[model samples]
Target: MRPQHRVSARIYSVSLRCAASLALALLVSLGCSDEARPKAGAYCKISEEGQASACLAPAQHAYPAFFRGLAQDKLSDEQAREVETDIAQGAQSERSYEALSTLAYGYYRLARAASSQGTADPETLARLEHWNELLSKAYASSEKDPRYREALRQAAVDVGSRTPPLGLRCTDADGKPARCDSTEAVVRAMDEARDQTGVRGEIGRLFDRVFGTRP
Candidate 1:
């Protein structure tokens, strides 16, 4: 039998942190709402505005809430860092993939958020690598067990992976024309790819010129 080849057709775009978002308030939308408190849920399955209360799965709940805060612009950069720190300390069932995956992701996202702010310390780098290790474990575990794939897919990429077809946009000083080119805007495009597809690692290195690794 011949060796099989792996091909992915997914096109990804690169994006940077919104330049003008420093003053943007947390955009909490309460419109199109649902308030059904699930009987035994940990996440907000209602998918409403304002903010998600919790996650259905205990392991998944923490990140959603934190990310929801981020999406809503509710959490300030400083506040978000606090949340990320707390998330890194999360715990689920003992020796459970879900728990470890969550922990690893929590640390990685913290790295991403902090990185955006031009803040990167030894602790932050350690946390990011730690998640990568956990993610690797989850990936290995997925070989024998398929259920763990989702866990790996979601949390693993943020640690430092490269997402392909990075769609990047570069704005000129005049702001006359915002150029969106995947080929020309390699740095920004790769960042967008990471944002969209959870790809990380090389993306950071490739964009180190534009994004800069440490503060």
Candidate 2:
């Protein structure tokens, strides 16, 4: 149970902070069409204009709603799990800057919840580690885009934690062990294996760089 493995499209949700609400609105505004939402597999596939955005719009809207539900205690554990799974799948399926940032912030909230629980069982520790990995991926994915990165960072900051400690161990170029003690250091390490040639390669490269070949 390594933390960095991508969860099956089977887990996550979000909050109603001003920033999250604004982000949800912005993503919604990206489309003018009222087309149906995409299923788990189709959400991120680029389509002609309005089609893709339309498909993703529901997921965007759902993130905040799910958050509000959780915060208000209106959602049961099973309901929360289902929404989280949709969110996790939606974020990965889209791989858009906004989607990834949303995922990062969602995980940040989950981590905060886990922290407030005041106990660390195996499940809790695993969740905390996974939360760290997701946050790192979100940051690494958005590295070249300061606007996106900063937006996500502020969202996490608004959650009251300055940065996520990813618990990554690094190595210098020569293969000697290195230390990534801060969020910046972890992201920089992820940047090491980033393939600037293509957008889709970022996550894969990040896994290679930080977690070795296995991810």
Tell me the tens digit of each residue's lDDT in model 2 across 1-215. Answer: 54543342223223336668898887777543332232222212223231223444554565656455435423334434544343344233344344543344444445445445554345534543444455456555554443334333433333323323443344445667654322443344444535455753665555456536334
Report lDDT (Cα) of residue 66, candidate 1.
Answer: 48
Q: Pick the candidate with the highest lDDT.
A: 2
- On residues 1-215, what C-alpha lDDT tens digit does candidate 1 reach at each position? 32332222121111223433532433322222222211121212222232222442454553455455444423344534433443333322232443443443344345445546564554544444443433444344333222233333433332224212222233434444454321223223323433443334444344444435322
Q: Count the backbone clashes (under 3 Å) in each candidate.
A: 22, 4
lDDT of 1: 0.36
